[model samples]
Target: MNIRKMADSGNDFLAETDSPLGLGESGKPIPSSPRVLSILSSVFERSIQKNEKLLKKLKTKDNVTVFHGSRAPTMGIGQYIDRISKYTCCGTPCLVVAYIYIERYLQKMDAYLTSLNVHRLLITSIMVAAKFNDAGCHNNTFFARVGGVSTKEMNRMEIEFLSNLDFRLHVTADIFRAHCLQLQKEGFGENPINHRPSNKTRAKCLPQIAGYTCRAV
Candidate 1:
């Protein structure tokens, strides 16, 4: 799978699937950290639940693909996103790019995005996106620490994700703006970043069973 070919393919599919929460400095104000956190929490939870339910059905049919990984997500999605925002250096745009990468992975692999894979996927995608978009990006080891995974595991997942994406990381201006617009439409436009949830609140908000530990086979 060539990156060129994949990019040439209409990413209208992205518009159809989960759109990004928002990005850049234009659309509406960059959402406040709390608002961005809320949007990401909802998006991650929805994707995880949707995929987990799908996995259960596939398991019944003996058709589930064993995702090779080990992950123990101590932080809830919001907290994780907050950490990612700090570590990735690419900030909100990286999150937007990560969301786009997730969409691409789902389309290319024909795989469900369950809790088993979402954490690793999010970490890897954000790292990759930061490298692509940010002027000064952290190394994979640093991101791994922030993401609660080993450097080796992160490297492996990064390779797997890039392979699955056919190495396509380019987000055209149009596609990027479209995702931001969708995110704004989804209610992230103009929320101030002043109000962040406490650790207790985040813990309460995260699903009790949200954490997963995946080690590469």
Candidate 2:
């Protein structure tokens, strides 16, 4: 979709809730909007629940996965993602692109987005998104600190994430639009991937996570 390029041409591609926060001095969107953060965190919460249900049915845990984490970290999804934005000041569009990267990895790899793996995957995806969508970006060492992982582990995770998705990180316009629509719908709980709170429903849904009161500027 060339998200960075789209910023200058106009936001014909973005939904009402997500476009404004992505704007930067160079025409790129700033770090992120609270609404987008709330929405994506909700989606991740659903993913965790769905995977847990599947695990229950299989009668086994599902921690046998890739990425660099040895155990699930103490931070919850909302806090962790909020931390990433605060530290890196990543553009809001990069967050969407990062979600795209996560979707690509899940669609291609035999992996699930559980707590143990989701954080690492998220950091890796966002890192990739920043590198791809922005003219300049933070190095892996900085991202490792943002993600609460060791630098070496961060490097390993970046390699594995690219490898698992076969380096297919580019998001086309159609795909990007479709994802935004689905995420918006999912956020509003009109037809969510999982059933739960829909405080993000500007139509009435993702209860904005606490402490995320400011946009990443």
The global C-alpha lDDT for each of the candidates, from Candidate 1 onward, is 0.58, 0.68
**Candidate 2: residue 211 lDDT (0-100):** 34
Best by lDDT: 2
lDDT of 1 by residue, 1-217 (tens): 2222222232332221122222222332122244545676677787778767876777742123323344434556666776666444443455666888888987887776765566677878888887775545678877777777778888878888888888988887667657655664565454544443334322211212232333433
Q: TM-scores of the models, in the given order?
A: 0.67, 0.78
Report the lDDT tens digits of candidate 2 across residue range 16-41.
Answer: 34444356455645556665677889
What ranges in model 1 sit over 4 Å off? 1-32, 57-72, 188-217
Score candidate 1 by lDDT.
0.58
